[model samples]
Target: MKETVFLTGAGSGIGKAIAKKLSADGYDLVLIGRRLNKLQETATEINRPSECLELDLSLGSQIVTDTVKSWIQDHSENQVIGLVNNAGQFLRSPFGDDQDDWDLLFQVNLMGPVNLTRALWPHFQKNREGRIVNISSNLGQTPVAGTSAYSALKAALDNFTKCLALEGGAFNIRVNSVAPGLVDTPIHDFHQKDDSGSLQLKAALHGMHPLSRMGQAEDIAGAVSYFLNPNNSWTTGAILNVDGGLSLTSKDP
Candidate 1:
């Protein structure tokens, strides 16, 4: 029986790539994102048994959780077996003492995934074989300047992923995270917005990676493919960095 996986942030970047990859592997999908048009585009491109929900994590909307709850309630008897908590936000804010930016980043980057997973826990507990994949970032491992809030949230997420894996392992539910470096995505374009030094900084970051190239969406998606496979029964509580050698550059001789 083909399994169903609910994937968030499926409108762009790594999420889009993962959706296409999983669809090609014959998985049913529930694609969640903030943009209706982009989500529809992903759905059309995949052409699988899929559904979409337009949701914004920054809105403090409970709609996403409610949708997931309803989905589990409706599909508990079906093969709904995996989740990809890939929705997140990134910003270039300084490490100011202001609570607003800090709280906002935590809410979107950390709390959103946590909340959704908590909501979906019952389904996994009942099924005894579901898996979760949280998309983190290389910044979580090595805190960089100018992205304090974003990096901190991802770091917290990595920790929480381990906790989830440990708690869910006995139930046969696997939990893991994927941390990617600077991928060639719109997020980086937004990160580089209007900065005169952006080009130099981008080049430097690219050069720092041992691969000497920015990561592609497919690169991250490949990791998702591996982590979610039924063949991967023995792996859990792992943080796989699919970052084109960016995270490993410090280990290089």
Candidate 2:
């Protein structure tokens, strides 16, 4: 049977890099994202057997369960053993009365992962083997102002990763997380680089890291790959920070 991994947000950024790395390492893929075309692009770049699913992680509950059910039915030839909870949206807090922002953050960032994991738990337990890697953020621990919700949700995810790890041991399932610092992904492309101000901000961000450079998606992908590798099977409940040493300092600008 093909060893397949279901990866959320596999369409781009860190998720895309992770997908590529896993494909190179000999794993089939089930790419999940909101955009079908984007997921197909990732599939087109890989040589191994792969499937793409258009899913919005924020729409938790029965939708998630149903999606998993049909997914299992459709890909019966593949043994799904890994899940990357990388689908998430970023948000800054202190929105005052904007309750929607907080709600959206909770649903997409925390609840979505929870719901999906719960939906997949039965399959993993039945197999008695699986791996889960969550893509979290450094802000979850080293939080700064105006990012309370995002940090808190990620912190919850980190804890959830740990809790699942503890419970999964009985079934030979290992759970871990990769908490990344600033990376040069589309999430950080809010400003036009043509402007001097934006250019200066980007430079400052690069300098903030002790490594004297901004992190690439591949940098974070390497850590996720480490956690997923069967050779490192003993490791579980670990939250590895792939932050280019940014977590070592109190810098964020």
Candidate 3:
């Protein structure tokens, strides 16, 4: 029987890359995201057995837990061995901007993962083995000017990863996070009002990375795969930085 993995935000960007990599590496996938069409697109591209679940992480904890339970019931043949908590909201706001944005960020980034993990805890305990990888941000460890809420949520997620690792250790479950730097994806398109601004912003991001280029989605995906691999069974609670050396430098370029 093939091992199955549940992945949130599997519609695009790093999540999509992770889906492709894991599929190619011979694991079936359960793709979860808000857009069914986009998730289906990713599933089709992977060309493997996958279930596309349209879910919004901002809906709160109970909803996510119920949805996950339903998913498990619906897909009984596939034994879920791993979970990738990659869904996140990026809000670029200074303090005192929109309080709603901050709440939404926390809901999606921190609470969603927490709820999902709580729901899956019993399942992992029953199985006696599991893997969890969270897609965090470089700003989680290094603070920046404009991304206060995003950074805080990711930092919380990083800490949550450690806590889950400790709790799940005796059950033979491992939890880790991959903190990625700037990657060229639609997530940044929100700030790109026009082609010129987009290009300039992209260039600036590239310059900020000590490696001299923005990271690719696959770069983060590779790190996620490393943690998910059963060969790395002894490792847990690790925050792997797949940031193109961006963490080493300040934001100024």
Global local distance difference test of model 3:
0.89
Better of 1 and 3 by lDDT: 3
| Candidate 1, run of 10 with poorest lDDT | 244-253
lDDT of 3 by residue, 167-218 (tens): 9999999999999999887898776786567678778889898899999999
User: Which of the predicted structures, 1 or 2, would earn the higher lDDT when compared with the native?
Assistant: 2
lDDT of 1 by residue, 187-243 (tens): 777647657988887777678788887898999888998999989889999999888
Over 189-222, each residue of candidate 2 has an lDDT whose tens digit, in order, gives 7655457799889989999999999889999888
- Sorted on TM-score, highest at the top, how do the candidates line up? 3, 2, 1
Q: Estimate each model's TM-score.
A: 0.91, 0.96, 0.97
Cα shift from native, residue 223, model 2 (Å): 1.2
Model 2 error, position 95 (Å): 4.8
Off by over 4 Å in 1: 59-62, 74-78, 195-201, 250-253
Model 1 scores a TM of 0.91
Off by over 4 Å in 3: none
Name the lDDT of candidate 2.
0.88
- What local lDDT score does residue 16 receive in model 3, on the 0 to 100 scale? 96
Candidate 1 local accuracy as lDDT? 0.84
Q: Which residue segments of model 2 deviate by more than 4 Å?
A: 93-98, 193-196
